[model samples]
Target: MIITVPIELPQEIIEEIVQLTKQRIKEEQSHQTKVNEIPPYPTRKQLKQILKIGDSRLNNWIMNGLKTIPFGKETRFDREDVKQFLNDLKI
Candidate 1:
């Protein structure tokens, strides 16, 4: 003897799943924006002090794209950027 069962998902459940998917996508976008937001600037000395890393190391990070340090032609470090970098380092 073989038993066969028909399985069907309710329309309400499908709608709920679609709504949840959209909500999750929106939340992910918001999170990405927060991550992409640029931090403020810090001086070279201040950055070193805060991150406890040498100038070369920080420069390497910038070069490798692990972090972003925007600067004008004069090349200055943003304090808030360093703070954010430090925060990112936290496990």
Candidate 2:
């Protein structure tokens, strides 16, 4: 046996859904802003000094994504992100 269901949503329901979607998007963007608040760039040496880790361990951490170290054509680290990562470690 087959059951029939309504094909179209009511206008009010659609509007509510749209509003909720927008609200959720706004919230997500704000959360991203907070996460992205990490600071200016720093070199690998500086980062290693700041975190007090050896080259191998630092490389491993970067590989594991414990910190937001960017790689590729440009090697850079956000200072604030490093600080935040360190701060997060205190917990």
Candidate 1 lDDT, 14-64, residue by residue in tens: 677777778998986775555444335555565555445797997886775
Among all candidates shown, the one with the greatest TM-score: 2
For residue 67, model 1's alpha carbon misses the true position, in angstroms, by 9.5
Candidate 2 clashing pairs? none
Which portions of model 2 show Cα errors greater than 4 Å?
A: 1-39, 67-74
lDDT of 2 by residue, 5-49 (tens): 356877778777777778998986775564455347766776665
In model 1, what lDDT does residue 5 have? 30
Q: Name the weakest run of 10 consecutive residues (lDDT summed) in model 1.
A: 1-10
Q: Name the regions of candidate 1 deviating beyond 4 angstroms.
A: 1-7, 40-91
Scanning candidate 2 in windows of ten residues, the lowest lDDT window is 1-10
The candidate that wins on lDDT is 2
